[model samples]
Target: MPLLQRWRQAISKMSSASPSRFAVLVFTSIIFLWSLLLTLPISSADGTPTRYLDALFTAVSTICVTGLSTVDMSTHWSPFGNVVIFLGIEVGAIGVLTLASILGSVVTRKLGLRQRLIAASDGNALRLHRGAVSESQAVRLGEIGGMLATVALSLIIIETIIALFILPVFWASDLVTHWWDAVSYSFYYSASAFTNTGFAPNPGGVPEFADNGWFLGCLAAATFLGSLGFPVLFSLVRWARDRSKRPGVHVKLTLAATLVLFVLGALTLWLLESGNSDTFGSRTPIEGLLGGSFLSVMARSGGFSTIDIDAMNDSSLLVLDALMFVGGGSASTAGGIKVTTLAVLFLAAVAEARGSSDLQLFRRRIPHDVLRLAIAVALWGAMVVGVSSILVMSLSGAGMREAIFDTISAFATVGLSTGLTESTTPAAQLVLAVTMWLGRVGTVTMAAAVASSERKQLYRLPEERIIVG
Candidate 1:
C-alpha cells in the first residue's frame, strides 16, 4: 500500500504484460478519464449539463474519431467541452495506440524487448532477412513521429484554409452574425468533417449549406482526403516526386479500390433513390448524379451529408451501410477494415475463381502474411459491428436497420447517424463506446494482447482439407 511498494507492483505488472496490450490499456484508461472530466459541470453552457454516459459516448466517439453521439453536441456542451472534444479528435486522428507506444518509448528511453517483438510480429517494422533492408528502433520511431507531425500539421493548415473560404460565405448569407463566431464555427465544422470526427457546433450539421452543391463538394473532397489513410497519401506524394517510379502496391491498390467502391456506391444510391420522392425525387439528372456521387464519397468514411440520411430509401440505406462498413484506408485517419484489406480479399477471391495458387495484384504476388492479416482484420471488424448492433438494438429497442447503421458508423468511426443515437439508452451508449474504442485501436491489436502470450510455433502443422461452398 506504500507509494514505493505501489510503484514496484505497477512496474512488475507492466513488465509482465505484453507491451502492445499495456499501451492500449493506458490509452483507453486515459480516454475514459478525459471523457469523465469533460462531462463534469466544470464549464458554462446554456443547455442541460451532459450526462456521464453521454459525455463518455462523445469522448469515445471523439477519441475513436467515430462521430456517433447520444446527445446534441452543439446544444449540450459548452465551449470548454467543445475544446475537450476537439483535443480528442486530434488525439484520435493520430491514433491512441501509436501515441501510447510513443509515450512508452519516451519514458523508458527505448522500447522494451516485448514491444519490439510485438512490433515485429505485427509486420509494422522490418527485421533483417539475410542482410536485406532493416530499420533501427530510432528510424522506426522517427518514421512514426514524422508521420504524426505531418498529419497533424496538414489537418491544421487544411482546416484553417477551409474555414477562411467558408466563413465569408456564411457571413454573406447571414448564417453567422459576427466574424469571430463565423470563423470559430467554420473551423470546428471543417476540422470535424476532415477528421471524420462528426462533432458539429451546428446541431443540424453545416446548416443552410447542407443542400448547397459547391459547399458540399468542398466538404466531400476534404472528407475524402482525410479518410484516405496517411500511408497511401504519403506513398502517392513520394511517387509524384519521383515520376519515373510507379506508386507502391498499397497506394495503387487503394486508388483502385476507392474508385471501384465510389462508382458502385453512387450507382446503387442513384438507382435505389430514383423513384423515392424523399431523396432524389424529381431532381434534374445532373443533380441526381451529383447527389449520388457525393453520398458515395461521403459514406465511405466521411459523415457529411447533403440530403437527410433518414429520408433515404431502404435499399439506399443498405448500400450506404455496406460502404460504411468497408470504411477507408489503413494507416490513415479513417476507420473500418481499410481499402487495402478489402482489396486483398477481392484479389484472393479472384485468384480462387481462376484456380490460381497465389493471389496476385498488378502482376505481383501478394505475401501470404499480408493476405492473412487482411482477412483477420476484416473478420474481426465484421464481428465487432455485428455484436455491437445486436447490443444496441436489445438495449434501446431501436430497429435492426437503425442499430446496424449506428454500429457501422461506430465501427468505421464514421459519424453519420439515422437519428437513433440521440435517443439511445445508457447501456446501448456504453456498448457503442466499447465498439468505437475497439474500432479505433483495431480488433487485431486487441486480440493480440490475449494471443501474444503464446509463443510463435516453430513448425507448421499438417494441412487438413475441408469442404467449401
Candidate 2:
C-alpha cells in the first residue's frame, strides 16, 4: 500500500477501535514517553543517569496519579525533572478519556458525535452500551462540551483557591524563608492534594507541617473536592446557581456516601489508634481527632498522610485497606472501585434484604445492568488487588500486612504506605506499578476494552433461577 493509504487505514482502524482500548493506549504511550524523559541525565539532581526501572516506576506512579515512589521524589529529581512530574500528574489528573476529549476538540476544532460519545462514556460508563442510565445519571450528548468546560474550569478555580489557602500557612511556618519557596510549596501542595497524588516537594513531606492544623485542613478540603468527581462538581455548580434545580441522583449518592465514609473512617481510626503511642495516642484527644480525620481523608484517595503508617495497629491498617479500596467518586481523579460502586452494592444488598426486585435509590430505579457493572467493577478490583498482593508478597518476602497494605494503596491509588514499597525488590515494584496503572485506568474501563468487540444478541435467553447463596 502507498504510505498515505497506509496511514489513512491505520487511523481508521484506531478510530474504529473501542474508546476504552484507545484510552489504555494513550495512557501507556504517556507513561512510556514520560519514562524516557525522566531517564535523562537532566532529570536527576546530581546529573547521573537514573535507573530505567526507577524512572519507569516514577513515570507510572506520576501518570497514574498514584503517590507511591521508589526514590526520594523531593531531592532525586532536578528542577526540570520536578516540572515533568508536576505536568505528568496534572495531565493524568484530568481522567484519561476526558483528556482525549479536550485534545479531540483541539485537533478537530469541534467535537464530532463519536468524540462526544467517548467523553460521555468517560463520565458515564452507561454510555458505552453496557446498560441504560436513569435520566438523572445520564449526561446528554449535547451537554458534553459544557461538561468538558466545567471540568477545566473547576480544576483551575479549585486549585487556585486551594493554593491561596496554603500560601499563608506556608509563610507562617518555618519551612520556608523566601517568598518564592512559599509560593512554590503552596502551589505544589495544591496540585498534589487536588490531583490526589501525595508527592511532597520537600524532604520530610507533609509531616513537616504535622502540627499545622490549618494546613492539613486545607489539604483535606482540596482532596475532598477532588474526590467528589467532575460530574458531581458540575451538578453542584448548577444547583448552586439555581436553588430550584436539585442535583442528580449520582451527585446525591456520591456526596452522601463520601460524607458517611469520611466520618465513619475518622471515628474508627481514632477509636482504634487513640491508645497507640506511635500514631495518635501520644497526642491530646483533640490532636488525635485531627490526625485521625486527616488520615481518613487521605484514605479516600487523597494520598497525603500526616500520621505514621508504620506505627498504626494492624487493625487500623485493615480499616485503611477497606477505605482505600472503596476510594472516591466516579469520573474523579481519585481511584479504586469508587464510592458509587460501593453505594450500588450496598443498595443492592438492602433491596435483597427487603425482597425487592428493583435496585431503587432516591426514587429512581437503577437498571439491573448497573448493578452488574458495579459488581463486576468490585470483583475485578478485588481480583487485581488479590493477585497483585500475592505477587508482591512472593517477590518481596514482605509480611502479609505490609504486602496487602501497599498493594491496596497502589490498586486504589491511595498512596499510603507501610514503608514497604521503597524497600521492595524491583520485581515487586514492577507489580505495584502495574497495579497503579490498572487502578488508574479503572476496572470497568479495562473490562470494556477487553470485550469491546462483543456483539449484541437478538434473542433472549430462557430464564432460570439459581439457588441463593
Candidate 3:
C-alpha cells in the first residue's frame, strides 16, 4: 500500500478502536520492551544475563506495580537494573492514569455513546450527575493535561516529603555504607510505597529500620494517600485552592471505605498474628499493633510488609487475601475491585433487603446502571482470580490456599506473596504476569467492556413477568 493509504488506514483504525484497547496495546508494548532491556546482561548482577521468563515476570510486575518478583531485587539485579525497573514503573503508573483520563478528555473528540458513559463512570473523579452529559459535553484535551499534572506533581511532592522524613532513620540505621546510597534507597522506598509498587531494594525489606515507628509511619502516610486515588487528591487540592464547599460522592466514599478497611485490616491482623510464632511473634504489644497496622495498609494494595507473609497463620493470610482483593480506591494506583465497588455493593444489598425502590446513598439516588457496572466489574475480577487460581495450582503444585492467595496478589496487583511466586512454574508465572497487567490496566473498565460497542435501547419488547428467586 502507498504511504498515504497506510497513514489513512492507521487513522481510520484508531478512530474505530476504543481508547481502552489502544491503552492496552501501548502498555503491553511498554512491558515487552522493558522486559527485553531487563534481560540484558548489564541489567543483571554478576554480569550474567537474566532469563527470558523471569525478566518478563519482573518487567510486567514492576510496570503493573505489582511487586511479585521471581528474583530478589538486591541480589538478582545490578544498580543499573534497579534504575531500569524504577523508570519502567514510573512510566507505567503515568500511562495507566493518563489513559484513564483520556476517556475523560479528548479534543475535537467524537466518542460513541458507550465510550461517553464509561468516561462519566470510570473517572478517577466521581461524576455526580453533571446535567445529563452526552455528546453535548465538551471534549477538551487540556483536561487531560491538568489532571495528569495534578496527579504527577502531587505524587512527587508527597514522595519527596516522605523520603525526607525517613532518610534520617535510614542513615541512622547504618544500613548503607554511603550517605548517597541511603538517600537513594530512602527516596526509592518512599516512591515505591506511595505509588503502591512494593518493590524493595533491600534484601530483607528494610528490616534494619523495620521496627522504627517514625520510618514505618512515614511510609504508611504515603501509602494511604496514594491509595485514595487521583480523584480524591484532585478534590483535596481543588478544595484547598478554590475553597470548595464539599467533596463529591466518589471522594467521600473512597475516603470512608479506605479508612474503614485500614482499621479493620489492622485490627484483624493484630488479633491474628500478634501471638503467632512466624509473624509478629513474641513482639511487645505496641510493636505488634504497629506492625499489624503497617501490614494491613500494605494488604490494602501497598505491598510492603514488615514480616514474612509466608509464616503468618492461614487465617491472617485469608484476611490479607480479602484486603488485597478489595484493593484500593478507583482511579488510584492500587488495584483489585476497588473499595468503592465493594462499598456500593454492600449499600445496594442493604437497600434491596430493605425493599427500597431506588438505591439511595449520601442523599442521592444511586443509578441502577452504576450499580450494575460495579457488579459487573466485581464479577469479572472474581472470575479472573478464580480461573488464575486453578491454573496456578495445577501448574505450580502449590496448595489450594496458597494458589488463591498468590492469584489474588497478582490479579489485584497487590504484590504480597507466600514465597510461592518465585518457585512457581514458568506457565504459572505467565498467568500471573497477565493477571498483573489486567489488574493494573483495570480488568473491568479497560478490557472487554471498554472495547465493546454501545447498544441503544430504542424499542422495548412485549413485557412478560418472570419468576424471581
Candidate 4:
C-alpha cells in the first residue's frame, strides 16, 4: 500500500511538470538506459569483445543520427549490434515524442492530453490551435504510426528493388565478389544511405564504385529524397494526387527553395574546387562536374562521398561548411538550420530589400512567431557548432577548419568527416555527443525548456527600436 501510494505521487509530480522539462527528463533517461545496454560487453562474429566506449559512441550516434564512429560498424558489431543500430535509427528518425504517442495509443486504446500535446509539438497536427480537430487523439496517433510504417516499408521495398539492379553492376565490376555479401552490402548501404547515417559495411569503406557516375548519381538521388523531410514528401504526394487543387504555399516555396539551393551549392563547389587536383584532381572535366554535383547535393545533409573530404582544397571546404550549415528540408531526416528556415530568412531579407515590413513567400505572409522560431533555431545551431568546435580544437589540437567541419557535421547530424573524429580526445567526443543530441531534438525544444520557468508576460511593453546594422 505504501509503495502504491509512492508510485501515484511520482506520477502526479510528473504530470504536473512543465512539458519541456518532462521531455528533457524522458530523453535523458532513455538515452542513458540505451547507453547502459550498449555498454555491456558484446561478442562479435569472430568472438572479439566490443569495448564500452565504442558501444556508447555507437549508441549515441544511432540515437542522435550522428554518424561519427570510433570504430568501424561493419567489422566491429555482430548481427545483434547491427539490429540494435537499425532499431535506433528507426526510433531516432521517427522521434521520441511520436513514439510515445504511438505507444500510448496502442496500450490505452486512447490518447491522453499529454500525448496530443506531444503530437502537436512534433508537427503531426494539421492545426496548432487547440480543439481544431474533432477526432480523438488515439486516431491521430494511429494515423501517425501508420504513416511512419508505410513510409519506412516503402523505403525498404524500393531500396531492395533498386539493390537487385545495383548488385549486378557491382558484381560485373568485381566490386562485390559473392552474391550473399552483395545482398547484405546492398541492404546495409541502402539503409545507411536513406537514414543519412553514413555507416558503411564495406571492408574498404565506400566501395570504388562510389566514384562511378551512375552509382554516385543514384546514391545522391536517394540521399536527397531521404533528407527532404517526411512532411514535405507527404505534402508532395498529396498535392500530386490532387493536382487540380492548388498546393499550399509552404509546399510550393519548399520545392522552389530546394531546387535553388541545389543549383547554388553545385555552382559554389564547382567554382571553389575547379583548380584543386586532389578533390577535382586529375579528373576529366566531365568527371569533375559529376563529382562536384554529387558533393553539392550530398554534403549538405548526407555524409556519403566518393571523393575524399580530407583532400578537398580550403575553398572547397569552406563551401562545404556553408552548405552543411544550411542543411536539408525542414521536418526531414536531415538536420541543420534546415532549408525551410533558410528560405524564410532569405525571404525576410528580400522583404527588407523591398523596404516592406511584412515578410512574404509564395504570396503568403509568414507569421512572426514562425520567423522568430527560425531565427532561434539558426542562432542555437550556430552557437552549438561554434562552442563544439572550440572544445574540439582545444582538446585535439586539430586545425580550425577540421574542427569546424567536424562540429558542423555533429550539429547537423550529417556524419561526414575530414578524418578528425578518429583522433579526437574523450572530452572532444563528449562535446560532439552533446551537439548531436541538441541537433536531433533541435533548438526550439531546448529553448522551451529554458523559458518554461519564466512567467509569461500578461501585458505588452511599448515598442522600442535599437540601432540597426
| Most accurate candidate by lDDT | 2
Clash list (residue pairs), candidate 1: 229-332, 230-332
Q: Model 1's lDDT to the true fold?
A: 0.71
Please provide, for model 3 over 1-469, each residue's C-alpha lDDT reduced to its tens digit, 9 standing for 90 to 100: 8886676456435534554555566577779999999999999998989999999999999888888999988789888998998887676555453543343335224443433433433452223233333321112222434455676797788888999998887788756899988888988898788878888887778565676788888878888888887767776776677774356677778889989999999888999887797678689878888898999898888888877788988899899999999998876778888998899899998998999878886787766656766787888899889988999998988998889999999988888888889888899999989888878876644433532433667998999999997
The number of residue pairs in model 1 that clash at the backbone is: 2
lDDT agreement with native, every candidate: 0.71, 0.86, 0.76, 0.68
lDDT of 1 by residue, 1-469 (tens): 8886676556435744655566577668868877787767753276545677777777788877878888777777777887888877877776544565555555556666443443333324222111233332212433454444556677788778777766766676665677776777878878787787766687566545756776777677777878776655655554567785456566677778988999999988988888888778768778888889988987887777767788888778899888988888665667888877788888889989999989887767776655666777888998998889989999999999889998888888888888888777788888888888888777537434434333556899999999989
> Residue-wise lDDT of candidate 4 within 330-428, one digit each (tens)?
656677887877887887888889999998765667765556667777888888888889999998899998999988988888888898886788778
Best first by TM-score, ranked:
2, 3, 1, 4
Order the candidate numbers by lDDT, best to worst. Answer: 2, 3, 1, 4
> Where is the poorest 10-residue window by lDDT in model 2?
446-455
Clashing pairs in 3: none
List CA RMSD, all candidates.
4.0, 2.1, 4.0, 3.9
- For model 1, the superposed segments whose C-alpha errors exceed 4 Å read 1-17, 47-49, 109-142, 242-246, 444-461
TM-score per candidate: 0.87, 0.95, 0.89, 0.87
